[model samples]
Target: MLKVQEIRELIKLIDESHIDEFSYETNGTKVSMKKNGGQIITETPTETKPATPQKPQPVQEEELKPQEEVVEKKDQETAAEQSSNYDQEITSPMVGTFYQSPSPDQGAYVQVGDQVKQDSVVCIVEAMKLFNEIEAEVSGEVVEILVKDGELVEYGQPMFRVKTV
Candidate 1:
């Protein structure tokens, strides 16, 4: 379980960073916080559930190797291949799962050829089950969507490449 002081520090760090929200759970305690009105709002519920023991499942080497290769290869190619002087990248502000839309059934927030202004919400990055709205930091035409939906993205992972308008 995390102490109040530690939680406050974590919130401070998040506030200073680009992360929009954070969540953590351990030892029957859960905490969820979000940036609201330039202040941190933390919610702690009193209800707790008993911990359950589970057997660990072994990961298949074939499955794991391909995923690792794909991620590394893509990151390298994205860094070296497409960007030009006039292009700008919209990168993941935090390590989390990349989502193009708010929900599975909804249409994507931005697609290739879409025009976006600075501060336009282009996607979501969900960490620890807390979905954060990610905004485009530049005004431009979205030339490409760099990441597929539901992919685990690292901090600074490029999500979109935009051509300045």
Candidate 2:
């Protein structure tokens, strides 16, 4: 079994790295961690091939809070969709900090109601200290901006919503 500090370090490494799944096993104890969207889930499953796998223990109520947050976030997105179903989004391709403009001195790359084409540059996403320019893949008019400037965004997070002509 890993020490508490060692396990925390592993979690930090996972948060910083691009790898989505990782597991550590030693002396018949295994710890698995997985990332979904921007959330990390840690699971420890005991191996019991020699004996009927003891019915998995029930998760405590405290362990269920994170799942509740995921559900709430989904409901919030649903509410946003209901406000404007015609709005199609351009989501972030990677997890990073979103930048609306190229630099501090410049204004935003695209604003609401601005017309755009498939190849139009919309914003930038900074990941691992690298600035990546984001492009719109669908031609339309920008209907809404889902994220704030300089906000940390997760993979597939909606950055811009457009209304197709």
lDDT at residue 41 of model 1 (Cα atoms):
32
Q: Per-residue CA lDDT of candidate 1, range 88-161, in tens?
A: 98887678899999999999999999999987889988988877888887998998887989999986677898
Residue pairs with backbone atoms closer than 3 Å in model 1 (clashes): none
Measured against the true structure, the TM-scores of the candidates, in listed sequence, are 0.53, 0.57
**Model 2, residue 82: displacement in angstroms?**
3.5
Reference-based TM-score, model 2: 0.57
Model 1 spans > 4 angstroms off: 1-81
lDDT by candidate, in order shown:
0.77, 0.78
- Most TM-score-accurate candidate: 2
Candidate achieving the largest lDDT:
2
